[model samples]
Target: MSKLPGNAGVTVLGDKSVEFYRDPVSFYGQRMDRHRGRVFLSRILNRPTVFVCSVRGARELLCEKSNIFQKDPTDLMTNMYGDTIVTTNGEEASLLRLSFSSLFTGNSLESTKGYVTRICEQHLKDLSSRGQCSYSVYKSLGTQLVLGLFLNVNPDEQPELYQEISCLCTQHWHGLISAPVNVKVPMWSSGFSTALEAREKLMAIIKDKLQNDKHGLVGTLGSLPLPDSSSASQHLLLFISALIPKALASLLTSFTLALSGNQQVETRRKAQTDADYLGFVLLEVQRLWPPFIGGRRIASQDCTIAGFHVPKDYGAVYISHAVHRDPEVFEDPDSFRPERWGERNAGQQHLLCSFGNGPRSCIGVKLTDAFLKEACMYLLQHYDWCVDPSTQALQYKWLPVSRPANSPTISFSRLDENPPGHSGS
Candidate 1:
């Protein structure tokens, strides 16, 4: 079969790279009408890649034929996390997921709801204390809450470990992932060595915590009744490294969207009705600005997406930006309209690929949703926040996690701080 149309070389890849870096928020929509269902072949960071921008393709790759598909992290990623669930596929991944399944549902989910509220409230209080919080600050607060809820890290009480791990995971990943290539460069030696050492130290802290008790619903494996064939410490490391970036990005995106939306605090408090406007806001944000623009998966045996022939072990990257922007699926797909989600239930909701579709869909969804709801509720219910009117529209960097490249400033005022019947922000 003829190769799918795309920028596999500088000839085709050049424009996409430039635009993605230059303007992320509006870039996808600008090209969506022209590129939907098109597979663009390109080399990213010198690696050959295929970006399938179709919902059907993503569903098949991530779900329908997931049996043959597998998780494939970079060589650098393999070094940091050996065989944790995030790195493994097939039975190994299942066991790791099973070991942690107890924490995903039932009593565990019910118990963690309180922590969600408390963490959001505390973080907002901290944000308010620093009146001029930027986009980066929101991400930091989200990361802190992720740790507090999952691993039980008390950042205030243990600043060293908290700050150290954050540095290693968030700031130092590029150095760590490039260790092999940088080993021969004299100037890169310090960063290369530091990455390895930091990983070890961070793992030690995580192991100690998991062996003791789970911070949120991630209870110790030993305490659970299910059979666990995985190392809880390594699993914790996998999740900690994997989840932190997405956690930060999602918070930034959701917060940015909420501040931009018309929904009010009083409007959100009355939940469980047909018109839960805030929930719609969250879904629409994910649809328009997913934390992860793309995800990688390997072809199991063989498959065809939109007439594309993908052989076994062939690498594929599904671009969510393409999938979510399908005009056939989403009307006025480029615009932010939260009300579209009001009537969507579990059945037709599959049309949205914000979390991907099928077996390999993101596991962090439930927790992510919880955190978003908690954060949104806390912000809207207790404060009036606004994006600086002078700042440019939401533009982001996709790598690591999708966040505003410029780090724009946002202001928040507690409800009580305002005069009675004060309306506009």
Candidate 2:
């Protein structure tokens, strides 16, 4: 039993902790039922934990003095991702971040527009030919787009390797959701082994490109401020590996919305524009279904959050899904409304934690935005897509990332008229 802070009192939750661990969203909501502005200190994962259900408490934990609250990387993420930017903090995090930031400049993103557009068009053509597609769009298209932009490869060229990387990411999530507290899981060991293999393959590809001076998309990476040549390659590979999983996870969540018939017509119409509807849809999906249960930060010293006393060294879990759907912050918390993110509410923008906030916010956000926008716009513009009515109210399994439990079978038909700004193939 872990010791509680002087200011905090522990609430012993027996099997309730198991229920919360099993499904956090539903459990959190149920625990907060009929209680307004209450902070509960409950046991989770067999550890004494503070569960902040109020919006004010969550905001203070995440935004206010967030530096004191550090991210506690899980065993699975640490083993697979290691000390890469996603799981690292302090000076090392800053240095690696600075070196990688150079790769996402306005010019770099603009330069890759052609690659993004080309991939989008190609994917649309392939899907259209299939007539009925039930493939994991994240695995098939989203992974390729992010990998191409970051590492400069056509994933299809090395389908087996790409498939392995995708499987590793998926399995990493599986281990997290299913593994018990005491077990020395095989999934963790396997995930790490697979990650190393994928890294070697990626390095080989990068080295081949560098040796042959095959300036494909990697030409854009030349401007990055790596400390040395070796570090540059290492950083590039690690960053790509870390980014690919998050990118695909987010993309799959957005695809869930599309399969639910949320924005079929709009996605098709906006596929040709500089801004993609997938961008908007991703923002919406993230708002609806965030990847993580929010981010965790350990308190540096004693603090008060929404009236609850948080002592030094305590961990704070910011529930992003709860904050994103807060009735006070959003108009209708449960409804899917993409237009809320448009120019109309530009001034009254709600502080969404999907990309996080402050200095530690997501760096690959622009690349993610670009890829999603391009993919959604292309798919929506060229094809009419919807989930087969036979399986309409499908539920998504949320862990590691959100994805549909049932086969998301969507049908597509090529449009008779070309979408605006798009030149039909």
lDDT of 1 by residue, 1-425 (tens): 55555544554444355555455435544444455535655554444456666666667677777786677755466666666656677876676566666676667667778877876677677554566566566667666766666677768877887787787675335554343543535555656566666677777777677667744545645575433434666656666673455555565555554554235444434432333666777777777777767767766676676567666655677777677776666778887666677643223456556666676565666766777777776666666656655455666666545666676666566667778765335
Model 1 spans > 4 angstroms off: 1-3, 7-37, 44-48, 73-75, 126-129, 175-193, 211-219, 223-230, 245-249, 261-275, 344-347
Best by TM-score: 1
lDDT of 2 by residue, 1-425 (tens): 22322222344534255676567778667656644433555555444456665467666776676666666655345554456666666676678778777566567667878987887787667665665555355446666665676555566687676665555545444434444233335555543444455556666665665555446446645655655566555555555553455545455545544533433454445534535344555667777777665666666777777766677766666677777777766778787766677744443333767666666777777776677666666665556655665455567655545555564666555665546543222
Every candidate's lDDT: 0.62, 0.59
Candidate 2: give the clashing pairs.
69-297, 70-297, 70-298, 267-380, 268-380, 268-381, 271-377
What are the models' TM-scores? 0.82, 0.77
lDDT of 1: 0.62
